[model samples]
Target: MTAYIALAVVVVIVIWAVAIYNRLRTYKNQVENAFAQIDVQLKRRHDLIPNLVEVARGYMQHEAQTLEAVIRARSTAVSAADEARQSPGQAQAMGALMVAEQALVGQMGRLMALAEAYPTLKADARMQQLSEEITSTENRIGFARQAYNDQVLDFNNEASQFPDLIVARLAGFAHMEMLQSTQNEQERAIPQVKF
Candidate 1:
C-alpha cells in the first residue's frame, strides 16, 4: 500500500511540473509576438522618414542645420530599430529606441514650427501627402505600443505568479519592459491666440 501511494505522488508531481512549464513557454512566446508587432510598426515609420526629409528639404533650403538634425534623429531611430529586431530581449535596445523616439519628436516639433515660416512648404503636394502618411503611421505606432505593453503586462503577471513564477524562473522567463511615457507623448492645451 505504501508503494502505491509513493507512485501516485510522483505521477501528480510530474503532471503539475509539465503543466506549469508549458504555460511558461506559452507566456514567453506571447511576449515575443507582442514585441514583434511593435517592431514592424516602427520599421514602417522609419521607412517613411526619408521621403518626408526629401520633401521638406526642397522648401527649407536655408534651414540646412534643421534638416541635418532630422537626418541624425532618423538615423538613430533606424539603428535602434535594427537592434530591436535582432534581439528583442535586450532592454537596452528598447531604451535606445525610446531615446530615438524622443529625439524624433523634438525634430518633428522643430520642423513643424519651421513650417509656420514657410506656408508654401505645407502647401506642397508631396509634403502634404508625406504628412498625411506619417500621421497615419504615428497613429499605428501608438496603437501597437499600447498593445505590446498590454501583452507584456499579461506575460509578466503570468511569469511572476505563484507556481508559474517557479517555472518561469527555471525556464529563464524575464520581465518585459514597459513602454516609455515621456512628456513628449503627453498632451497640453495649445496656448490661445487671442489676436
Candidate 2:
C-alpha cells in the first residue's frame, strides 16, 4: 500500500513538471514566431527604401542631405535587424534593434516630407507605388510587433508566477523582454493644423 501511494505521487509530480515545461516552451516559440512576422515586414520595408531613394534622387537634386540621412538610417537599421535575428531572445540586441527601427522610421518620414515639396516626384507613378507599398509594410510591422510584445508579456507572466517560476528556473527558462518601440504616443500622433 505504501509503495503504491509513493509511486502515484511521483507520477503526479513528473506530469506536473512536464506540463509546466511544455507551457514555457510554447510561449518561447510564440515569441519567436511573432518576431519572424516582424522580420518579414521589415525586410520588405528595407527593400523598398533604396528604390524610393533612387526615384527621389532625380527630382530632389537640392535635398542631398535628407536623402543621405535616409540611406544612412536604413543601413544602420538593417545591420541592427541582422544582429537581432542572430539572437532574437537577447534583450540588449532586441532593444538596440528597436531603437534603430524607430530612427529609420523618423528618417523615412523626413524623406517623405521632402518628397511633398517635389511636385514631379509626387506625380511619378513608380514613386507613388513604392510609397504605398512602404506604408503597407509599416502597418504590418506594427501589427507584428504588437503580437510579439503580447507573447513576451504572456511568457513573462508565466515565468514570474510562483510555482511556474520554480519550474521555469529548473527548466532554464529565462524571462523574455518585450520588443518595445522607441516612439512615444506623442511622437506617433499627427500634428493638427488649425489653419
Candidate 3:
C-alpha cells in the first residue's frame, strides 16, 4: 500500500511539471511570433525611407543637412533592428533599437516639415505617394508593436507565476522586455494652448 501511494505521487509530480513546461514553451513561441510581425513592419518602413528622401532631394536642394541626417538615422535604425531581430527579448538590444528608432523618427519628422516648406516638393505626385505609404507603414508598425507588447506581457505573467517560475527557471525561459513608446519626454508633453 505504501509503495503504490508513493508511485502515484511521483507520477502526479511528473505530469504537473510537464504541463507547466509545455505552457511556458507555448508562451515563449507566441512572443517570438509577435516579434516577427513587428520585424516585418519595421522592414517595410525602412525600405520606404530612401525613396522618400530621393523624391524630396530634387526640390530641397538647400536642405542637404536635413536629408543627410535622415539617411544617417535610418542607417543606425537598420543596424539596431538587425540586432534586435537576433535576440528579440533581450533588454540591451531592445533598448538600443528603441533609441535608434526614436532618432530616426525625429529626423523623418524634420524632413517632412522641411518638405512642407517647399510647395513644389509637397505637391509632387511621387512625394505624395511615398508619404502616404510611409504613413500607412507607420500605422502598421504601431499595431504590430502593440501586439508584441501584449504577447510579452502574457509570457512574463505566465513565467513569473509561483509554481510556473520553477519550471521556467529550470527550462531556461527568461522574461521578455516589452516594446515601449519611443517618444522622449518633450515629445510626450502636452502642448499648452494659449488664448
Q: Which candidate has the top score in TM-score?
A: 3
Of the two candidates 2 and 3, the one with more favorable TM-score, higher being better, is 3
Write the residue-wise lDDT of candidate 1 on 34-137 in tens digits.
Answer: 77887787777778878888888889999989988988998888888788777564688778878888788688778878976998998998888878887887
In terms of lDDT, which candidate is strongest?
A: 3
Full-model lDDT for every candidate: 0.79, 0.89, 0.92
The candidates, ranked best first by TM-score, are 3, 2, 1
Ordered by lDDT, highest first, the candidates read: 3, 2, 1
Q: Per-residue lDDT of 19-131 in model 3, one digit per residue for the tens?
A: 99999888888888999998998899899999999999999999999999999999999999999999888889899999999999999999999999999999999999999
Q: What value does the lDDT take at residue 165 in candidate 3?
A: 96
Note each model's CA RMSD in angstroms. Answer: 2.8, 2.3, 1.6
Residues 55-166 of candidate 2: C-alpha lDDT, one tens digit per residue: 9999999999999999999999999989988867678889889889889989898899999998999999999999999989877888898998998899889888989999
lDDT of 3: 0.92
Can you list the residue pairs that collide in candidate 3? Answer: none
Between candidates 1 and 2, the one scoring higher on lDDT is 2
